[model samples]
Target: MPDAASNDYSMLRDAVVFLLAAIVVVPLFRHFRVNSIVGYIVAGIVIGPHGLALIRDVEGTHRLAEFGIVFMLFTIGLELSFERLKTMARYVFGLGLAQVVVTGAVLASGALIFGAGWGQAAVIGGALALSSTAFVLQLLSERGELSSHFGRVVLSVLLLQDLAVVPGLAVVTALGSEPEALAWALIVAGLKAIAALGLLLAVGRLVLRPLYRMIAETRSPELFAAATLLVVLATAWGTAAAGLSMALGAFLAGLMLAGTEYRHQIEADIRPARGLLLGLFFMSIGMLLDLATIIPQLPAIIAAVALLISSKALIAAALGWCFRLPLPVAVNAGLHLAQGGEFAFVLFSLAMGAAVLPMEMGQFLLAVVAISMTLTPLLALAGRKVQARLEQRAAGGLEALMTETEGYSDHVVIAGFGRVGRTVAQMLDARDVQWIAIDLDAKNIAQARSRGLQVFFGDAAQDAITAAAGLDRARAAVITLDNPAAAASALRNIKKKLPDIPVIVRARDASNMGELMRGGATSVMPETIESSLLLGGAVLRSLGQAESEIDEVIEFFRRDAVEGGQRAADDEQ
Candidate 1:
């Protein structure tokens, strides 16, 4: 009984330490415009056994930290449906396969030249061939580039790498088997994986939507959240039971729910948990770095890190180029995927346990991978800078502008191609007005382009994107970005560039209308106010109020609301 109490107290203390480290470190990194992921890692290094020794249970911490990857993959799956996956088949299968194969072969050859045996070289090459999915995805999301062309390309490669983990593990296991049994072991592993995936997909498709619908019908937020957690954990457990990675199962679970109506709610419910756990995962990665061991071999480790990053980056870029991606985009994708991935740790651990990798060599490789991951944000920043330079130098020499806005004078410029912007475009289309739209969603842009619409992919709040969209030649501009901050930014940018241009902005609620108007919007349409007015008018009509009277009442209310908002804006100014 005493031991049990002590155990509970120890766990509580560790949790507090973890939270304190994150609270202290994350904000400092954010202050300098650095990615918060770097901060989490730094925090782990500081509080970990190697540093202050506040948290000495590295293995136990790692077990909890892995849920972060599971949740991250689940959220990523929620964003992508099977249809979207099908569309990305070329990159996922072709370029992704080529990347893993070519990169693995080159690195393996290098490993062999360095006096490593075939089994060890194969393990080293395969492990380092993959890039950090969590780091890359989180960083891309932070920079708002996950929907960019290169971002999609990066995602495609990462997806394939995730899928490759099963096979990589199978190979690791095979190495420890007798030569005659090795082939059989791999075949069995592959079959088990396929069966697990098939079962999960079949069950998820038939059950997840109904389960969510039933939960949602209860109208209990807590119940709905509990159901989401259940689905994620159950799916992860099922896959792990079948000798597959838990993260893959979580992703599959998310993919199953992606096409359902409850996807957004599920995403919202899971986001906080995902962020917290994912940060812990990064911290765990940091905890793996032993400062004492690294300091003794710093120069050699640095060389290995450089070699690994450069080789992977060059291979990824060359493959992207061969797959018809632009040089700049290909290079950017390469840099984004240059680092050794989380799976490398898993594979190395397996190899070390199976006696395929020497302990000394494994520790060195682990240190190299961990350090490379820490440098990812810096590398990504460098990649963006390089891409910008390349694009600027060859701006006119590339393919025709994504949107043909050169001859579109006196056209309407829709800043966001979402539901509200789409409706506005449809109204303009009825009048035969030539208009173009700018949006950040790659999927939305693709669908619009397929229908022969002049919708281009870009951030509406950016000066360059707006200029390219011919905002100066626009007769009017509409800011319909769903995010309040984004809408305000677009309004301000448009007013700054073409001060006299009439800009209409969409606000999520009346609370945002005044700020948007003050930011130079000629008109602000608040969805909440409009929705309430419509509902009120309906109620009045149901009570037998005259149509003309109801209309007048609504008009009066709308006018009063706008005037009230303007006065509020004036008072604030």
Candidate 2:
């Protein structure tokens, strides 16, 4: 009854409160320079239960939140590529593993200190160990840091947290009533994961790519989309049905698709779904915060939240320094990743289901995750400022290195100039970076110099071209390349000879998450799309947005792509 009857009129009810939050707090947060997510959560709390009791039926709201998570995972899957994962193996395995072990250890200790037994304490710790991937990544993408060094490390660790949600959930579930069963269930889960992975690896190498290519050759986008969905959904279902979590299934599907030739296409298709659902996911968090219950505990809870964030940064910084990254880089990376994410929600849910944690405790933890996630944008921005300052201070010593690569006499080193670069040179009047662009086409190079922009035109992937580009001491290498592989390879080569030189590379895709961590990619911006989308959404939402229609439109587009039919009806135009 709570799930069905309550949901029936939920939409009508939600419309008003959601709007109230948007109309009031959204502008307030913007006006005060607070992160918008923080405003949204605060709004949810104000109109949520225990406040105005605007969302009287909590069950219905939770149901919609579930869809938010699903969409969130789907989008996370879209942003990943196999090669990209392999490139940041350090962050994936090392950073991720360390995060799980350390964060869990710390939380488990806290629970024990709070008077819980080992089993109970461990479950509590497990819940606390998780963070909000949806909030963290959304904020990161918004800041255009997905391809930055900080973003890569943070994402690697977060991805680990997401994957860890499976067993952690199982542990919480097992510990609730039958604590003794926890150990056995984990062993079973581990074995199942291995077998599933093996089966996927074999099938992936033999079947997936060719099948997708065959599907693509038919020029049937719907079939391609259907096949893509089938791969992920079926695998996710199989993993969950096999005594694992749905998160594992999704991650495995992404891993399996990593090596495929059609990886980009699959990523592109899934991206829009990821974007929209992601916002809803955050909104769902806003719905969950029972501010009244939390108000009295605000002081202690705020301290805990601050501790949770600060400690993680220290942990990350220590790890980065140990890895021999620049002190500035290490610190920035640490600060950028200081918060907890959505995976924490799963742990709490599992624990509640297992009865290891009381419902109130889980609710409290949700409040914590929501608060932390909402604060992420502001935190990241501040940390970025600190990082920029640190970089500037360090750059004073690196100036000679920069000058060496930028071009001593006359040269052109072009990173992605596009429209912006074209105009930059016209104002220069024969001034050049003493390096040419590493473009795929000669027409681009011709256009650059036709406007009298210093230009060299060739793929940076070639050793001959890098050599020709005067890469040895080209003053500064303006790596304006778009593709990840090309950009990364170019950076590696630049670092080979001019190891200390400053090089800037353009990062234009969210999927190119690892580009910022490459050897010589001093700056990174994975995509400008998210900001544009955010602006668009704000405009739409402000002009009396209708959730039902938005949902219908999104579902239509997704289903069209999913079913491989009616490929954009207006496409005939």
Per-candidate RMSD, Å: 5.3, 15.1
**Highest lDDT model number:** 1
Candidate 2: stretches off by over 4 Å: 1-36, 39-43, 50-80, 204-207, 258-265, 358-362, 397-573
Per-residue lDDT, model 2, residue 43, is 70
lDDT of 2 by residue, 1-573 (tens): 888876667777776666666678878888988777777667766676656777666666655555445544544554666677687788778867876788778878877887777876786666666666666766776655566556677778777776676687667667765757878878877787678767766776677778887898999888998887787667666766766555556666666666567777888877665554444455567767766767888987798788777877777777777776666667776766677666676666766776777877677676676677777776777766665456534432123224334544345466445554554345444552343454433335446557654454444655655665566655566665655666677778777767777776655644353434435455544445434455656676778889666556555643443233222222332
Number of clashes found in candidate 1: 0
TM-score of 2: 0.65
Best by TM-score: 1
Cα deviation in Å at residue 531, candidate 1? 13
lDDT of 1 by residue, 159-199 (tens): 88988888889889889877676778778878999999999
CA lDDT for candidate 2 = 0.64
TM-score, model 1 to reference: 0.81
lDDT of all predictions: 0.88, 0.64
